[model samples]
Target chain A: MTAHPLHVPPGPVDLDAIATDATPGYGGSKSDGKAALEGLGPELADLQERLFAEGRATGSRRRVLLVLQGMDTSGKGGTLRHTVGLVDPQGVRISSFKAPTADELAHDFLWRIRRAVPAPGYLGVFDRSHYEDVLIARVNELAAPEEIERRYDAINEFERELVEDGTVVLKCLLHISKDEQRERLLARLDNPEKYWKYEPGDIDARARWDDYRAAYELALERTNTAHAPWHVVPSDRKWFRNLAVGTLLLDALRGLDLGWPAADFDVDAERARLLASEAST
Target chain B: MTAHPLHVPPGPVDLDAIATDATPGYGGSKSDGKAALEGLGPELADLQERLFAEGRATGSRRRVLLVLQGMDTSGKGGTLRHTVGLVDPQGVRISSFKAPTADELAHDFLWRIRRAVPAPGYLGVFDRSHYEDVLIARVNELAAPEEIERRYDAINEFERELVEDGTVVLKCLLHISKDEQRERLLARLDNPEKYWKYEPGDIDARARWDDYRAAYELALERTNTAHAPWHVVPSDRKWFRNLAVGTLLLDALRGLDLGWPAADFDVDAERARLLASEAST
Candidate 1:
């Protein structure tokens, strides 16, 4: 196995030195990788059904969230369309965090993210999540150095609460090279079909790439917790990125002690009544 | 024309007297209605494009919000799937408000709603919106009667601000009969497939049907402002319901003076450069 381990355990790590293209745990060909990704769909769907069913039936509410943080054109949307797309849209809650609105900026940063967090049985995907506070806010000097430092602790406490309340939190930092980003942005500008996806401000973000990277490094080191560890996925290869995320979801789901809630109703009587009604109608 | 009118202009309306199956503006057969719905897709698509485009371009940032309020099984989800379904999902933002969390309940009712209103160039749908404050809160006596009264004015003022800020606010109350709701609930109970969608708490809501109706009547009469009027939708018939909302959305879209934004970039130069870059790559 070429060691591109995607999951970073709660510990000290240097994001600056991590290879964005490393596929440490993947030992498969591109064909095998794609096949593996496709294969996980059924398991995910089944797990989601059980989770959703459980939430409806009982007091214990189980939820899963994937928090995605990345640079411009780092395949967040692609991951959404491919990985989360496999689940029932009804069971999935996707909250894409754009630049905060004036109203949102007035409140705490997590206010919007907290509202959008998946309810029990939902598989939530944060397209660009609360990590923006640390990444963008830090890089742009939007907040003071000390205040930026304080966000790391606040985020950890929040995730701890989510985990305590039965929500599995998996954060992924999509690590892509600046060169790859330039190519992607150029592709967007070049393709008329993709012009809608382009924003002139993305170029502004791109200009602050190094500063953003430094900010990300600090975020990963400071906030990554045992409860909500950050996984820096090598995202230069889009295929590998999807496969890695899909596998992580599959593992998290399968690890849960999950089952369908037993139906409390008299099914035979209900079924008979429905049949009688249908005949009468 | 089998007239099934969709829009309810701002006015005093009696919820008790309002027909749950009134389709005065819809004069078509089922097949005709479905076709008209299918037919509106492209124009809705076009209007949505212009709305979304206008937002992305400089200066003018127009938007729309369709707030759906109804009793349990009144087909809010169906409307979302069928009516809002016609537009590009990318251009649509759907916020399904559930029971507020401890954190949310701590704040004012409109806090979460204000956060979820669509950005410029987006058509936002509230699957069960702030009206819950007045409906459920009033029906359950969750707040003091005086406090409940305050929310109506608060909602109107909140909505007025949204209108003043360039969002076309359309509120729809999907009015389904108590008899119709009973049938829907029984259907869910009878069919195993629908058991997931059936919440046990719905029966409790069903029990308070009259109270809820009274609450709805008061809400409709009080908050039906010229700025953000409430339309009582005849949702007992699903197809008519879908068609009515679709037509309402189409009319709202057409009502807007929208056009594709002129390109801000040097299109010819950008295109030529993209073409040249493609050749080199």
Candidate 2:
């Protein structure tokens, strides 16, 4: 069995070279990948508690921010359900950024983004993040070229600040082919039950494929900083996408090297209190 | 294979008669009960979407409110994971009411409860609900007997309004024996990994077991109105508790008999637009 590489480090990333169907970091079949995912559940739960406890402790500023940016059928929701679903909800904050509201549009783009950052001792997940401003904004000419360029620099500075202040920023671009998106959209149309999830405007989004791809390439190249690097995940195969993203997340948490805080109080006295209280009752 | 009777209708209640060890509604082993729970997932997802779509459609106000009240270690979290975990997060609302803050204490107790009701087309679960006002308040003498009795009447009236407005309120008391609580508390103590979940104050709560049980019985009897009936779920066997509660919830949903709302737009025109759009591109 060959070792699968999960992370694409901060450097020049060739989007075309990464196949959407390739399964890296997975040794066996779907069942095996599932078993592996199940195995990670308890570890994530335990690690999450320590992160939570550390945050709850005096002046500990440790947390994680996972940004998942992808095309419409690239399986961000599936990844969240399969991976982050394993941990206790108490320690995980999910921020699904939708379109800007009237008040939200009144503020800067990062204003809502800043408001949604996870507190210390949390594993925060951003479903569609501020990256949309660069991706969709550039593709559709929502912002001027000069403004978009300025936004990229602003994003880099914001991420650097987050990293310096104790947050681990992991950004993943769920890479899928245009053909895959077409099939997924068609399936939603065929199933009436899935009508709530479909939108005719998605067809328009598909028409801007090349533009979006070029915008993504520029965004990936421009903002892949050392402090907050970008990972390109092949997301056509749902199971493999779940596996790779889960692997990346587990590795990142493991890298934190968090330890249980030592009990500052006398353990013997607490045990004695329990014993004494039991006898009195 | 004996059938289990899980739901207790609106009537006088007895805490002692319900056997915590029994696993009714489940005729098979743990693996089989698990398989049954798994089967409910897709149906729940489908029903939830219809409910969500119905809510989104127009003015249809159909929803589910599952109030889970249990003593310590009766598996409210476990039930949430196994059962409600199956549905989409988009169509579910979870309100885990903890001890009230100073602002909350200043207002009437039901003020906070009113704030967390589920919107139309969502299945809402309250982890520790408004019943705490009656349970802990009565047991710990936080409120006078007259005030506690008044709260019972207030609760019934509040629930009546919810029922009239298209909410099916299913209140479940996860009834576990004192012995089961002791075992679970000790298990938490024995495992270092689970220390974060363990509270030292739990032992003090156990000391007032009979008082709590009597409180639950009186609360159940007083508030068991026709609009919102209390279901005493025997929860010692974790698998059975999930199955019984899951069954009750699924039944309640099926009872609503919801259907997918018809597409308001012209279907042929939309399909033709997609086909034409594809050819033009």
Candidate 3:
């Protein structure tokens, strides 16, 4: 399998260096990209089933965690509907984090996140995950500067623990330009069908676009590790974004090298039992 | 828009009366039925989104709970993969109930069931559900006969509470014959790929099929109410079963009469704000 080309390299990061509309490894037209994404369904489903089977039969602890972070209208929900929808929903656990509740605020930030981790053999998706602690928390001054600085290390340690325990943490920063966000927001405002998605607070966030961008750049730079790397997915084109994330997931599942679990019971004995039961019926 | 013919009416239910292979309301070929199920997808998705938007915008508590109860090898998992897989996973919450833990057993049976109910606007599916308390427990005499008798009333009241609270409870018993189950078990035994799904205890349960069927009949007769009806879906043909359940879900959604949520904010103001933001960018 070809290596994903969107991986964020370790160094001082510049968000503007990559174009939000560029379809990095894919050279296909929009229609072709969609077809390619649909083509990934069978293989992704098979691999996911094998992984699930391994966990049930052999008690394998291996799992996958796909964390999606993006600006408003950067398409986290779309990625879930299009890319993650390709696999069996039984084998996937999706948790979307919202603003911290009073109970959540009382506990450590990771408290809610820890509870939502997927069980063995499940693909866990975090939409706007713990990274929000550093992103929004930083931009809005929700925490003290020292405490905000400390969360970066805390997140790294928490993710490293997950990786060491056999979780393949694949993080994607859905990169979109301010112009694209403005256009998407305007589209939502223009269509009554999309009105429910538009929030007044979205404009407030857009107003602090440069601040959020700097926060994201720092978050990506500090947390990008060998065990769990961050991929910057260009998101201006919804089709390419969906296709890239699907391909990345397929690659991760393929890396598991999963196979059909061996039967624990005697096959011949089970066969005889079935036949006798059939005869009796 | 046709009424589902598989619904178990308020009178006595004979498990043997309903043919396990009959497609009562549908008269299409297997391929045609499959196509028909696929055709329900777009409408299902649209209605689900409307329901979701309504919940988000207006705080509507209306939700759908699909309870799937069936014998082992009766295609509950297959139905989930094919039928429930139609809608966006974000809008669907699926919980598979297994043997209760010590924590769960300490409380009432409905304790865990209550915890897994879907939030407002979400479509919740139970792979196996509270019905198990009646079916497996009564078949095995796990509870006292008097206690078991009282649970029928308890379940009815419980479902009534859910229904009155704006939940549409749609229960389906995936009905299959003993011969069909034997064939399915045999097929599992013959295929190593299906080994993970086969359990030694499944044969144990198969040995007491008649008792389990009797228990099911009693449970359905007692708990079947005007508010929460039970549908006996024939599971001999996988395609028909998928289509039946998908159609039932679509009907339920359409019955909700969901419309696109009206915008809460001033549309023109947000539009102007977006344009101004674009100008600033």
Candidate 4:
């Protein structure tokens, strides 16, 4: 089969443009994020029920890959919680990849990740993803320069392949200001309940904020394709960030228009027979 | 807090008794498993909605760990898929633990599992869990005899603590006869799509069926506390297995009587502010 050239968008879409067009500015609108969610809750509920029901009936297990990449304290976890909250659990699966195992690094970086992708008719949310090749690997100077460049190309091709074959790829970079991150880190240290989530490595990383930002910008420039465009959400206001990110995912999934596909009656007939066998003495 | 003693059911309420009473030739009703789940689909849907909504409002996550430990080809995965189908994706999370990570082995076995438990007011399902300590470890002789004994005591304490703190632990051992397992394994070999799920190791274990059964029986005996009883499900019939396991979880979670612990709403004042905000916009 011939591989299709990826349809990456021209130049990264401006974060400012996304903020203005997609989401109402934080604290500027009559309905805040919480209120908006409260208002949308019931409708979203019905939508989820219908989507999952249709998905199962048609057996159209369309795979969705939600790749979340962000700066420190950019609310990746929060967005994951909210966005996943809006979908059907049965039709979704999440895989959070941490530092690689020895076996993982021994092979291609994509080896472990490819195994984790959602099967058809499901959503797979990645807490941090293959972008680490560009982000952390670059930031730490871990990859030889040439290998790093190759990964960017492979990722573009990989995403294109998945999208072409019915996987929906939605990538997000939750962008928070350096100042806001410092404040959040301090708060995490202060709050005992959140203490377990913090590590000393986080403080070391915070010290290199500018380097990380540059890496992220380069990653975005190279990888933002039409099939999987990156949404640089201004997460200075988490409430606004949640609303914007939630809207993006809710829209993309709805865009799929995955009404139930036709199923042969044989399985249904067999299922009835199976159930009947149980009922009969 | 003083750790409580393990709470076993008095006399005949344990899995052994249940198994004996449930055996078809032992004069128990044939369809007890199927009958238990008669109205479960709707009930589970309703439970999932309430569970997710509670997670949102309270931000206190709870977990539903569905520990499915059974004999080879005892329909564990099928039961999991069928049951999760009835749950809302938002409030539920499922983790399938395979081989241990290096980090997992470095700590107590339960350490990795504890991290995966749902935050608060959420449901977490484990297809196979730390019980593998007794099952696979015993089967493979992976641990020293002393360590194996220590783990059972540790698991009992671990489960008791989770129950005390509000995690609803529902454990199911899908019990299928030796003859039935051979049938399912043959079916897996017969189907192309199911080939990936079949491992050759399964057949070797099938060869040692009695050893595995002894291991499972010991596991159920040591850890079946009132808070987390072991439900020895008759899984010879895959459909009935799914229904029984799903209904068991539904019954346990529904028994919790979970509702939105009253939100502190300043009703009149908030209504006025809401109206005024709408007017100003």
Q: What is the DockQ of each candidate?
A: 0.11, 0.20, 0.66, 0.07
Off by over 4 Å in 2: A1-18, A24-63, A86-93, A103-122, A137-167, A221-223, A258-281, B1-13, B24-42, B45-61, B87-93, B102-121, B137-166, B264-268, B275-281
Per-residue lDDT tens digits for candidate 1, residues A77-144, read: 78876787666555677777888999998998789889888888878888898889988898888888
Off by over 4 Å in 4: A1-64, A67-91, A95-123, A126-168, A171-223, A230-281, B1-38, B59-63, B278-281
In order of appearance, the predictions have TM-scores of: 0.71, 0.81, 0.97, 0.56
Candidate 2 lDDT, tens digit per residue, B48-158?
767878886647888999999998899998888778877766456677788898999999999999988988887888999999999999888988889999999999999
Q: Which 10 successive residues of model 1 chain B have the least lDDT summed?
A: B272-281
- Which ranking of candidates, highest DockQ first? 3, 2, 1, 4
Report the lDDT tens digits of candidate 4 across residue range A1-281: 11111223567543333331234434445345667655554554445444554444444556667888787677887776665665445456776677888899998988988988876656678889999878889889988999999998899999988888778898878777665766676665555434434555665576666678678767888888777777676677776777766666666667776443333334344333333332211
- Per-residue lDDT tens digits for candidate 1, residues B111-143, read 988889888888888889999999999988888
What DockQ was computed for model 1?
A: 0.11
Candidate 1: which stretches are off by over 4 Å?
Answer: A1-57, A81-119, A133-161, A191-281, B1-5, B9-61, B81-122, B133-158, B191-226, B237-240, B257-281
Clashing pairs in 3: none
Question: Which candidate number maximizes lDDT?
Answer: 3
- lDDT of the candidates, in the order given: 0.78, 0.80, 0.89, 0.65
Against the native chain B, each candidate's TM-score is 0.94, 0.93, 0.96, 0.84
Worst 10 residues of 2 chain A by lDDT: A272-281
Give the TM-score of candidate 1 (chain A): 0.93
Q: Indicate which candidate wins on TM-score.
A: 3
Could you give candidate 3's per-residue lDDT for residues B149-226 as a string of tens digits?
889998999999999889999999999999889888888888999899899889889999989989999999999899
For residues B1-281, what per-residue lDDT tens digits would candidate 4 score against the true structure?
Answer: 11111233533333333331133322224365445454576777677666655654555556567777776677666676667755555456777677797878999889888877765666678868898878888989988988999998899899888887767888877777666665666665555434434555666676666677778767877777777787677777665566656766776678868664443443344333323331110
